[model samples]
Target: MGSPDPLEWDFSCPDWEQRLRDQRSLLPDLPLDEVEASRAVSIFDRLRLPDVPGQPAFADAAGDWARDMVRAIFGSLVDGERMVPELFELVPKKNAKTTNGAAIMVVALLMNLRPRAEFVLVGPTQEIADLAFQQASGIIDADPDGYLQKRFQVQEHVKTIVDRTNNARLKVKTFDLKVATGAKPAGVLIDELHLMAGMPHAARVIGQLRGGMIANPEAFLIFITTQSDEPPAGAFKAELDYARAVRDGRIPQGRVLPMLYEFPEAMQIAEEKPWRDPACWPMVLPNLGRSITVDRLKKEFRAAREKGEAEERRWASQHLNIEIGLALHSDRWIGADLWPRAVDVTLSYAELIARSEVIVAGIDGGGLDDLMGLGLIGRCRETKNWLGWGHAWAQPEVFDKRKEIAARLQDFADEGDLTVCEDPTEDIRGLADIIEELNTLGLLPAENAVGLDPQGVGALIDELSGRGIAEAQMIGIAQGFRLSSAVWGLERKLKDGTFVHAPQALMNWCVGNAKTEQRGNAVLITKQTAGKAKIDPLIAMFNAVSLMGRNPVAEGDNNGGLDRYLERLSA
Candidate 1:
């Protein structure tokens, strides 16, 4: 490979190359003599731009940053003695992130320290991983010189291995429990982590690769994704927490560096001229001007804003990194008129308590690897408006505290609100114990039920019936996925200025963190794609709807009404 003629382009002037050099210097101010500046310059020189049909060309700063990051990653990996895994998690959306990360993976495979290194590119699904593979192959096809094609060989039906003559043998695999069992991955790139749902399974698979990475401590495990859910927990949340710790100096220094690009939690877009909100694109997106045009984003996100759901609007804002009122991904479902400003609410919990004659409580249980949420919804008989109400949360660790849980249940019941609690735990023994304790305390309301997650707790269902708690409902099922009566009810209530929530941090989090997934006949509701999509709210919403005896007529309701459905838990 020969260097391009200096006269051909003006790198001598204040162009991308100079910008790359400046960014490279932003490193911990390490001594220039020791750093591989020449090698860094070389990698930047080879950085290629793929053909994106309509988008503006990548910004120079973005190109420079990508080049600098790749160089730094390589430099860190090559050092045999000083090897630490570095994480590159960014929030930049589709255009810039995917294209850039794909380029980095291709280059890493093409030019690596190990000859025929076994590299794995993993995603939640095969199709997603294939997209990356196609990009890499396209780069080879688009290579001006026949370098990549000549170097790499494709054995017709067999594996398409990278050229061993050079140094890298790249292999790609999607995250599968069965397939990933015994494999040793030299380098692994995880994409769209926001879509991952099951943590324990993912953790086990990732753990298996640890022993294999010993040879090359520089062996990378790169996670690249856009922000989907709020953290303080979950895999992504844990990652965000650690990254923040590193930035804030909470955790003693280590090399698992994190780069987060998100709008601050405080910024809010006004009802009028919401598109003008800058909270959509914070410091995280450097390719704002070039790759992701504001005009294009405005057009794309405009429909989602019409969903008429505050929760959905918050989701569009957080995930798309844009303000509400623009189009949303699920345009028709999310109505824009929902979500009255906070100022509209005049009554506090105290006033609501004084006036509320009837109250119904909904407790969404967070079992192992899930979040438990308690929402106290009160109904005004005259107005038929479910008053904006109180709520609480018990972290996953506290699920075992039956006494405390029962007491809290009793407390809500005494307030004439504890009508139903959804216990979506696989451990029916534990949930039964909580119900038994509540019953013993006489805290159980005259008409109340518990929603059990039927999918995983079938065996325990029979046992619950034998114990006379046959009314425990099975949750995390049916239409409540994302478009349930409960969700729409909440949406309608929010829109019409009726539903009231106490503004608890976790509940707001649960609301903001939720996302929609389309299933064949029914839509599955999920909260934050941690390792895989979690149906915390599916169970929660079922409990909320089933207990209040307030099932709205949505598409997915079965023949059994809410009470009849709960009665069949044991049957």
Candidate 2:
């Protein structure tokens, strides 16, 4: 169904009708209350706070979605019974997105009639997470009840809050896998969601929320953020993807309310005078004249353009709503608008391997403390798609068990597949237990095997070489197998069914914890910080790079460890 035309709805929707009813009730049926009307008018007239107005006078005070969002929150509290369970508001950055998010969070915390309302604020990182904390605290301080300190008990980190009344709690924290595992939250608000795509840990944490959400039937999940200038991933991308589907009417229900403030891809930055795109002023920024200044935008735009910072330019135009990289970054590898769902192919892994003529395996190793990943690929004879044969990962800490890992390697070798292990480490005595097991299984006979060390795994190389393993190198394939390349490749394959993996939880963890950097060319794997107080992405990359190696395969065949299956098919 197409979205109702702006004119047809008559604003009879429950939320709209309720707002009108509220407005009517707020005003008396008597002679005009100049004082009340004037106060409302001042809200629109006075842009800044303090001297700023209290409430919006007209319904058009903000963009439709923005207004609708405010109404949704207001209705959820005061209107009570009629509130929707979920509110997805996607607006580009600098469009007062954060300010609006902060406002809703404040309302949820203060107005709920419950003795203590629970609220959770999540950010992609600690600093990003603190934005909501800072904004909410400021709003409460300005309230009359001394609410900042007296009403809500703020704790060591902004993540925790206690209600002075019922000892109810409100909290804020960065998206970490462990923090939210079994959390029973009443309301969840995510900020700077675009950054979530960079880490897999966020996915695990969010998954826990989805399952645990049933406890509070009336709980709300609020996904609010701007566009991602990088390869879209994580919750932000998920929200935007769903919103676009809603806007296009691809989905029957309009669950998500998207209030995007993005400029056209063809916009030009060097159009003589700045603010060249007139269409940009209103669509991209709600605080254009209020919190953000036109001069500030112009100066930043010129600097980014002159410096040829294409990423910065795209970020400014899309996230900040300023026109910058109109000409440069427009040639993106894949446009954000080109989201296509994969066509379901129902062939099982064994069946796929049975029909393939070539097979190849890609091994991504984790650090001594990281995760080691292995992927098997086989060419599907029918669809020609690169069928995902299998995917596996072992914790490096566990792989420290030489004998156990060796047994696992022996299994791969016994299956008669071309098994490729990145340079074995001292974790298990040069993976001796594994090599011996592989030799016993008679996969490559230990004569043709090679160890790869793209970085300087000199000790590993020496040990493997001493053990009589081949000293072959794979610089070309290894270079192409870096984090950025592997992620992009895996994403494409997964989306296209060119790569398939058996259902495994750890595989999903690696996929979700992997975060892409602003470079738009590399990815960062996150790790727990020294204090274990927080997690960082550098640790994952360290482990991912450790898995690089070269493997000898038959010419023109991408045997990512599927040769055994190909031999079966040939037989």
lDDT of each: 0.47, 0.45
Candidate 1, residues 423-457: lDDT per residue as tens digits? Answer: 53433454455444333323234444444343444
Model 2 residue 568 lDDT score: 59
Worst 10 residues of 2 by lDDT: 529-538
What TM-score, to 2 decimals, does candidate 2 have? 0.48
Model 2: per-residue Cα lDDT over 1-571, one tens digit each: 2332323212112232233223221111112223433433333222222213663322333334444454443443212331344555545565556655665665555444555556678877877767666655655544544535687766755457676766666677777775576677777778766667556455567768766666765567778776655435444445665655554446644544443444433343233433454344444555455546667766666666676545555656464544321123332222111112222236344554455443343333435433333344445556656544333333334335433233233333333321333544433242443333223223332222422324544554565456554544222124322545544554555555454443322232233333334354554323321121111111222222222212222233324435644565579
| Candidate 1 CA-lDDT value | 0.47
lDDT over C-alpha atoms for residue 2 of model 2? 30
lDDT of 1 at 110: 56
TM-score of 1: 0.56
Could you tell me the lDDT of residue 156 within candidate 1? 29
Model 2, position 96, has a per-residue lDDT of 59
